[model samples]
Target: LFGKKYIVGGNFEYETELGNIKDGKVLKLQGLSQKHRIETTKMENMLSYNIFASLNLTEDFSLLGSYTSTKSKEYDSDSLTIGGKYKFNSVGDVVNTYFDNLSGNKNDRWRGTVNILLEAEDDSDRTYFDMDGNPYPGDYAASTLYVPKLTMSLNDLKSKWSYYFEGYYKDNEMFQGLKTNEAEQHATRVHLEARWNDTFSRGRYGINIAYRNETSEKPQNYGKKGFREVKRGVHQIRLTPNFIYNLGNGFALNGSFTNIYEYNYIGDKEGQGDFIMENQGGIDYSGLMPRAFMRLNLFREDTWHDHNNATERKRLTQIRPTFRYFFGNGAYTQLEARFPIYNGGYSNETRTQIIKSENYETRYGIKYIQPLAPGLTGTIGVTLLTIKAKNKATG
Candidate 1:
């Protein structure tokens, strides 16, 4: 019963930028506007506090609680966290529960100040207030979030394999209006992860799985009249397994796989299911100077709106290989190439007059770096690309 303290901190930031930026890589429509290029100013202020206390109830039990608050213009929130652990001395097992309540504001905007020039109206006679006489919304789009989690983990590392499991539930409510623009969401998640390594192989591997179910209700535009409430539900599951191996001699291989499955339903309609899988692999030859690196990536996805209909599947495979050489003069040269293949089609049950399509692409590039002066450097590069396409029935 000796630890109790309170800490306070805050900060302020301001930024200004002038002139517009032009880059060809960016689309014209998404480029910055010319009018606002004159000057733009941003200001932010934040304040926070931390309060913690611990009490020993008995020789076998203890209590801990903490409160934290953060206030800012762009992001604002406050949270209360309290957790405790109970130990079963006879069985050497422990159970823990942690609870948190976080509430905050979102999307703060100032919307007043529009000049309306009416006929024969002077500056003093014109109305200068915002359209609704209010600079911001009444509620400021405030939201409350709650998450309670339970975790069971092994504290002792006597075994080569260790594992932990965590489960949590979340509820978030945002008040827009009572029925017009209000929003509420609820979700539950379970996560499990494990890791194992062998000293003989000098390799390590890990696996993780997560499952979540979420439902949300929010306001939406109903036709041309106004806003109405809508409900949506989602179910998602993901699994990931990865590992790395060292074959020695400055060579190593690493690979991982992730699979995601999701089902979405809206109102009373039949839900649709989506499945996607990604695989990534890489090989590094640090055995050589200026080293050689190569990577392969594969992605596939399948979507089924209804059980009676055929599913659509798409696949893509990519390979990237590069070689680089470094000079003692602070210069380097690199050669790179990319090969990718794309294939898409409908299931046989759903196939009609259309045929599946396949596309192949190959690219090659060479780049060189040289020291032009004491403090100046230059780069030269060239790239070439080719593409080909065909269909099931086409030669």
Candidate 2:
């Protein structure tokens, strides 16, 4: 992007990774497991910077901003994003706002991840491989994040239906002291959309919805409230439908469907327990040339997990199909397929004890492009795969 009237830009980056390790003496293949220490060493360094700005502030208002910085020796971060926009001339409208701030230095010991809520334990699924047993490498904390957003849209409407809305907020924190392993979280989000069209005819349709909510608290014994504050909540909902069609010599078709629902409340205000459900669909096709394409997909998922006091149920199914072709000098061809199924247990099992698994896969590929000499080009490819499975156990 370039400037025109107060539009600036900047970018800089540096990266490095070097490795050296030798003292080897480990090898014992066959069914795995038999290594007596193979050493490794890696050192990484990174630096980054970015800057941006835009303004035209009067003619219906506008301003945009950006700043980003990153440094790593294991993490250091910075970010700032700003946005604003407003315009309305009768029925045509637009509104937008955004804010962001992020800061970091994270690495809290005992196998990191902010100390995993001080090595969480509520009824043991066991984890905590060392500290008193020796190898406990972690500790470097200080983190922060905040985000805000809002959006509204309905532009140049001459009516065929149009609408959009959005809202968002997020906050996260970690400091590793204030009671012990301090952590915090909060989230909120919402989105909506609607559409219908034939602007010039090719068809279009759309509907979208989204919602999210989250709350978390830590410190319930990391120092006895020094920051392991166990409190959790999460909720999510989503629905989507989209379509597009244009079937004329250049062909085109598109489709989308999605449904997702989730709910979880643990400890701190428990009720409504656990839940999850998901569904997905996809379809796509494009003319036979100029780089052909095809796609099909379906997915389903269900969960009802709730620990120790038992409640378990899980189901998953997935299917995917893909095809691609292109040839002119840059030859290409591809085919792909996948299927998956798994059904789970508990919910007072039955249905033959409810546990099943199935899987199948296929893949194909071909590529060839050779015209070496004058602008040179060369490529070669080969790929093939096949897989099948049923009821688990495989070798």
- Per-model TM-score on C-alpha atoms: 0.46, 0.23
| Superposition error at 344 for model 2 (Å) | 41
> Which residue pairs come into collision in candidate 1?
none
Runs of candidate 2 exceeding 4 Å displacement: 1-56, 62-83, 88-145, 155-162, 167-169, 172-190, 193-225, 229-235, 238-262, 265-395
The per-residue C-alpha lDDT of model 1 at residue 68 equals: 65
lDDT of 1 by residue, 28-105 (tens): 222334222211112234455556554555444445566666554443456665665443332212222121112332
lDDT of 2 by residue, 217-327 (tens): 433323211333456676767666667676676655666666656666655546555556665556667665568788777766666665544565666666767777776
Candidate 2 Cα RMSD after full superposition onto the native fold (Å): 27.0
Task: Tell me the whole-model lDDT of each prediction, alpha carbons only.
Answer: 0.51, 0.51
